[model samples]
Target: MWPWEHVAVGYIAYSLLSRTVVARRPGVPELFAVLLGSLGPDLIDKPLAWGLGVLPGGYSLGHSVFFAVPLALAAVGVAALAGRGSTGVAFGLSYLLHLPADVYYFVVFGDPPAYGILFWPLVPAAGGSIRGDLLSEALRYFTTFLADVTTPEAVPFLVGEALLLATAAFLLWRDTAARRRGRPEATTR
Candidate 1:
């Protein structure tokens, strides 16, 4: 999978899962924030790698479960203060979505230089310790499919990924618009 692939998949997963995970919650904007947060780890890593010649941070502090813990706790505190359990839960779901995506990326693509929070406190204390091999095989299959269908180069991957991302972006825009119109259910806070 490529960046666009991950983005598109993550967007779809967030859109679909957010509904169930944050159902009956208020604040569509906050829900979007959470959904964006779900992609925060990779989002952070990508920009840093492109510009600073380093990671989103020096290490995994931004992507690790250790970091999300404080965020989750903070959100909990906010909800407690506001007396809004539903809001807390919805925000928490966004953080929850982040973990699985990180786990899958790590399991398949390898740890992001030095970060792994797939299992959270369960997986030691270093960047990411648990290892996986099946993901590579799957990547191979995906690459093979790409090769079989088109030229074996970056263009094929890039084009496909772009289309995927564009579609997801459109859907997200649509979902957002629908929410704004107040014609359908959307997180309001």
Candidate 2:
């Protein structure tokens, strides 16, 4: 999934979860935390793999359950100590969700679920290696993605992604507007 797609999925999930469970929307800080979490895995692994060739693929270390789980737990623990438990939860949930989202993306594209990406060193990602410097590689991938999405076969997926992104944007706007109105209950810290 693209960065925006990851953010959309994370925001939608976190928004619904906050509304349903806490009866409130996420606050600005929580939203920012979620954004960071949504992109954290890619931020870590991609640089190591594509930029520095330190990892075997773009799905090692940061994408692995072993590292992610521990990192999230540590983040939550540290945040709790500082009285920011909700922010930590937001970050952790979004970060964890990224793994499954990637797998789901593969499945949606008619490829088998790439669950091995979550296991990392235990079960290596199939046939991925260093491509190039991060900037060039990202641009190359984005170009390919643009071309792919323009194809007739990508219409259904594109439509679904559009709806998902629209929903997330609307909800975020609603939350922000409510906060601007000084409605204390509309915000969650």
Candidate 3:
């Protein structure tokens, strides 16, 4: 999945979870933390793989559950100790969700879900890095997506993306409006 898709799915997950678990909505900082978590793997792995060629592929290191789980646990532990547990939860959830999202997309596209990526060095790395640098690879990916966007197989993905974006926008607008109205219960940092 793309970064925006990861973020969109993460936001949706966080919003739903917070609504169910917390009495109040999450603050802006918490939301940003979630978004950051959603992009965390790509931020780390992409630079190492595409920019420096330090790893075999773009799905090593940070993309692994072995790395992410312990790190997320540490985040939660530290935040709870520091009285910022919510932020840690937000971050942890977003980070963890990215893995499943990648798996989900693979299944949606008719490929077997890539459970191997989660284990990293325990499991062998997948072959084939994208050609060229990060910017070039992203451009190539987007171009390929555009070229394939009109096919029947792409419809579900396109619709899903649209819904995710629309829902996020609606939620953001509602939150902003409530904040602007001086609704203390709806206030977020």
TM-scores of all candidate predictions against the true structure = 0.48, 0.93, 0.89
Best by TM-score: 2
lDDT of 1 at 7: 50
Q: Roughly what TM-score does model 1 have, to 2 decimal places?
A: 0.48
- Alpha-carbon runs more than 4 Å astray in model 3: 127-132, 184-189
Q: What are the candidates' C-alpha RMSDs?
A: 9.0, 2.2, 2.6
As a TM-score, model 2 comes out at: 0.93
Task: Please write out the lDDT profile of model 3 over residues 39-106, one tens digit for every residue.
Answer: 99888777677767778777888889989998788888888898988888889989999988876677
How would you encode candidate 1's per-residue C-alpha lDDT over 127-165 as one tens digit per residue?
222233334433555686567447544565457567867
Model 2, CA-based lDDT: 0.85
lDDT of each: 0.53, 0.85, 0.79
What would you estimate as the lDDT of candidate 1? 0.53
TM-score of 3: 0.89
Candidate 1 clashing pairs, residues 3+ apart or interchain: 26-189, 27-187, 27-188, 27-189, 28-187, 28-188, 28-189, 30-189
Who is ahead in TM-score, 2 or 3?
A: 2
lDDT of 1 at 144: 66
